[model samples]
Target: MELPEEHSLGAHRRVSEARHTISEILTRSQNEHFAKGNDLDFSYVSSEGGRFRVNVYRKDTGIGATFRSIPSEVPTLEKLALPPIVTKLCDFHQGMVLVTGSTGTGKSTTLAAMIDHLNQTRRLNIISLEDPIEFVHASKNSQVIQRELGTHIPSFAEGVRAAMREDPDVILVGELRDADTISMAMTAAETGHLVLGTLHTTSAVKTIDRVIDALPVEQREQTKSFLAQSLLAVVTQVLVRTPEGHGRRAICELLMMTKAIAKLIQTEQTHQIPSQLQMGRDLGMQLLDQALLAAITARTVDPDDAYTYALEKRAFQKYVTDTTMLSKLDSLAPAAPVPPTNSTD
Candidate 1:
């Protein structure tokens, strides 16, 4: 039997009630009625001043809701324990820096941290477009203006276009969910404003492909050209159980755009992108597999969990102590990459 208890991002309490009772609580807390066949995304503040990101959606069993506890203060890159190199991505005056991960993986927190860093260090105009604003930023060094979708604008595309005309030096898009928004972000980057955005992808290569694939066949080639010029880096994150099993930690794959990598993108040789990441340690790029391998080597993360998410499964095969589990993982792993052609064209 499914329990009435639901987990919030940071909260661990179990609330026992009927499903309808839970829905009523949500409606009362947010004061928004989500009609049938429609969903609502918004933030709620507790009587204690705690904030949570809430989502209510239609489900087969009736209305389903999920809540993610938002930290009152945004953490810094150092606080998140992300690499020092991550700070360099934020330092770029103009270009696109993409933070990508699956849902519930803290992509929002990473972007918030970057914005927080800018808030503490830089003097510029920072504009954010969120579905429903989560963390609130008060201007310290950089000026911040946060906008919500339903409350402030109709869509992220409109907000982005409007941001361009508003004299923003940095624009934060909560998600590059569609082609138009992604295209607008690239355009903004090309026009000399640093654009920080998120994508729902697993690796750096897939992140690049997602942008190109989202476009029409007629627009893809040109979009690649724009992306090749405007993309500064792609940081893909995966959360894994920490060594103590009491919390989670981010395993990251950072793809820093370089001349050779950019050429590979232009030539559409994206399969070779992983090879570039392997050779890019001095340049601050790393594959998800590499990060997983390190985490495994340090005994900071379980080998079994790392293998489950690894793109190149062979890297962690020897590290996994459970033969039965290794076999189980192999069954679910995708087919390996095709060998590169040696013939000169």
Candidate 2:
């Protein structure tokens, strides 16, 4: 596939050279990561002294890999543009804190920031299980151990089980993609280990529902109870282009698991979460649409961008102030066709 203009390295050298380079990297990664099988789902590759998480696969054109550049220096929460509320999550002793969003929404970056905060402030064992291990954290006040999925272990479920034996004070499961992993993560939290995980869900309420619904029907009730007892907070973010068009900003929805929230999750009344979040302004909780409105009001994000990520498009329409964006919004609404122009035609 052709690379995007921004991430592209320009038309440097020949196409064959680029393909050859990518092929060689894949060969080395496969040999190092998968010695017994030919699967290449996820792997890490180092190029030009920088590490990248690569997803290698076959395309109709040829073998292709998508590269995500990992920053060498870990950024703090404030530097990453995360709300100040997220910093408190690092201070939680034991419970599951989830960073959730769609792909390319900076979930990994936010998790890295949280881990970095813990590394600087706490003297404890921190274990991380990632598919390719995006960020590398050095031991500071904390003892940090990062294990890759295929390199250090086989899967996240197995890794979480192993982390329990490692006597970890905190465990970061790269993602909670399945029932087994989610269950193990909750157990880890229940057993007094702070667990951080990521999910691909878009909103707080959906995230809670996703976790419960990921389990078997019989296991769901028990898992909901586990989640109700162990979940600390759910932070959902979406990246929006800045008004200046130079960089992107994170519009966040933060749900801190309060007493009422715990009851809601336990009783499986997740649909009422938005109303609770609206009333939780003093607790630093905000819905995704609220966050977007704040960004729009601050003039940092385009109104149309806010509308794109808003949960309720009709409700968010009132916030569009840009004339061009308003025109676009108007165009999207169904138009009433002129009644048959009888004799005028």
Clashing pairs counted in every model: 0, 0
- Tens-digit lDDT track of model 2 for 1-345: 442223244533344565566557655657555444344655554646787777755544434567777788998998877888899889989999999999989998899899999999989999999977888999999999999886788889999999999899999999899989998998899999999999999999999999988999989778888877788899999999888888888889999988999898888789998999999989999999888988888988877778888867777777666557667767888988988866854
Model 2 worst lDDT window (10 residues): 3-12
Every candidate's lDDT: 0.85, 0.84
Model 1: colliding residue pairs = none
Root mean square deviation (Cα) for candidate 1: 7.1
TM-scores of the candidates are: 0.86, 0.86
Q: Which residue runs of candidate 2 sit more than 4 Å off their true CA positions?
A: 1-19, 27-47, 318-345
**RMSD after Cα superposition, model 2:** 5.5
